[model samples]
Target: MKQDRHVSPSVINRLPRYYRFLRDLLGRGVTRISSKELAELMNVTASQIRQDLNCFGGFGQQGYGYNVELLHKEIGSILGVDRLTPAVLIGAGNLGKTLANQVNLSTRGFRLIGAFDKSPAIIGTDLVGLTVQNIDSLEAFCRRYNPKAAIICIPKEAAAAMAGDLISWGIVGFWNFSSYDFTQNHQGVTAVNVHLGDSVMTLSYLIKHMDGFQEEAETEDDA
Candidate 1:
């Protein structure tokens, strides 16, 4: 396993894409693939693919390229997909229910041990086979299950206090959808904050600029 911590975050981010493509290739009975071929499939340059993989000690041979199955396994190991990480969800709202039902958490190395909510109405409800527990029981539940990660789907106003509570109960990682900056509030916490509104805004910006780019291209072609 590549244990280098010096790898850039950009390179780290690209590893999952490499893993996914490799897995798909393996599924399609592709035994080996050259960097150029993989790059073409991923819409990236061959040199960029080589550079990203090199950060974790590139597996491709000069003539043989990379073994699809082996590369998938290596990237999986790097991403800790083989390890089952216990996690708990901290809300039972519409978004939370959707995530619980739709996300294949176990396939991606996480197991949702508990789902929680403050409302009595939602407390006893079933969410993806796990019974929704009251928020008051969070501390005891965490102590019992000893989950390493917390999935925060509560409102932004309630996020900080819940995060602090989870951190006190030994949760080290957070998948935050509450739009609260957990990392900023708590130093050394591993957090991935998902802001759906921000993502939509970003996509809207890209689409607007891409239309402008196409118009410019058309004008240049006419000229």
Candidate 2:
């Protein structure tokens, strides 16, 4: 049955939010939930949820709602959050240390099991609960621990070399925080570039548009 079930990336992205909402509803002792309720919580149309779920085969009745417990289990299993995904960090700088400290990764199926760095000063230091092992140990660490994913926050100049090493060590998924372009190794790994400057620019654009919209709304409200 699991082999027959197919999930698109868009559907995969929404599963965690749905799972969290279902957990909240269950805590409130709610048994059944309508598609419209889910749509409202996720700020999407009711038909969208229906369509996404229908892709995996229909579950709810025509008038009645979905089973809260069953939906939770289904979404959890689909997103791979039911079991822990071993993860590691490949730097010990400020950005790397901050990512290492993030606790919500486990709830989303990722666990920060270890970290590495080139600095002798930072190496052997404890980052949260995980120690900052030397960079020389990277290959051995990956082979031994077999992490499902890794976060790369090394310097821009060092990122490509590190990425090459990671690929050689069988790391296919990467959350790259460096400023370098990973175009060369794009085919070999799943890389997510966290560009802080680009993110700030996006925020500024949203804030400008939002301010104009608020002004228009206030004018209409006064009229």
Candidate 3:
């Protein structure tokens, strides 16, 4: 299936989830599935599944449903999982090391080409297979490898300058673990600032104010 330039962000965001479910289906040896069946598994409407897939192009036939393996492959292609774009990490802290070792880089379409840090202790350490290099080597390394993306795992105070340096080095995409917000002035840059703290706070809110929790507690006490 061919990608459309003007697809909605919501649809774009759901592509990975769709890709994951399809991959699971393929693993289960399922050969084909109707939109309704896929939607049920995804907790969405059948029409929604059809509409989202139709954004790229028609992949289903009248009576044949969708070929599980082929659909999974095509969705992965659309998500750029086959691209393997070169990527680098700037901060070799605990979170950085964790991401390096745990995250499936190939499935996400990135190849970790380099890792860098300013601390003397971390500079020589091994993160997965990549050696943690001195921060001084970052610009030169980026120039050599021409990494298109960067994973920022530094503190908020230093994120701005780091972003500037990366932009100058021709890095256009960022997976920022810091809280810094990169807005309009970034030009052609595409950044996803992942605030782990904010996510925890969101979970806190969900637990503290969850619907029917208070009533359930009262009923339990009475029981």
lDDT of each: 0.70, 0.65, 0.71
**Order of models, best lDDT first:** 3, 1, 2
- Please report how far candidate 2 places residue 3 from its true position, in Å: 29
lDDT of 1: 0.70
Q: Clashing residue pairs in candidate 2, if any? A: none
lDDT of 3: 0.71
- Runs of candidate 2 exceeding 4 Å displacement: 1-82, 178-193, 199-223
| Cand. 2 TM to true fold | 0.45
lDDT of 2: 0.65
Per residue, candidate 3 scores C-alpha lDDT tens digits across 60-79 of 98887998998898898887
The stretch of ten residues in a row with the least summed lDDT in candidate 1 is: 214-223
Candidate 2 RMSD to the correct structure: 16.4
- Which is better, 1 or 3, measured by lDDT? 3
Write model 2 residue lDDT over 61-152, tens digit each, in one string.
78897888888777767667547667778888887876656535664446676799989999989886566899888888899977766667
Worst 10 residues of 2 by lDDT: 214-223
Better of 2 and 3 by lDDT: 3
Per-prediction TM-score: 0.46, 0.45, 0.46
Say which prediction, candidate 1 or candidate 2, comes out ahead on lDDT.
Answer: 1
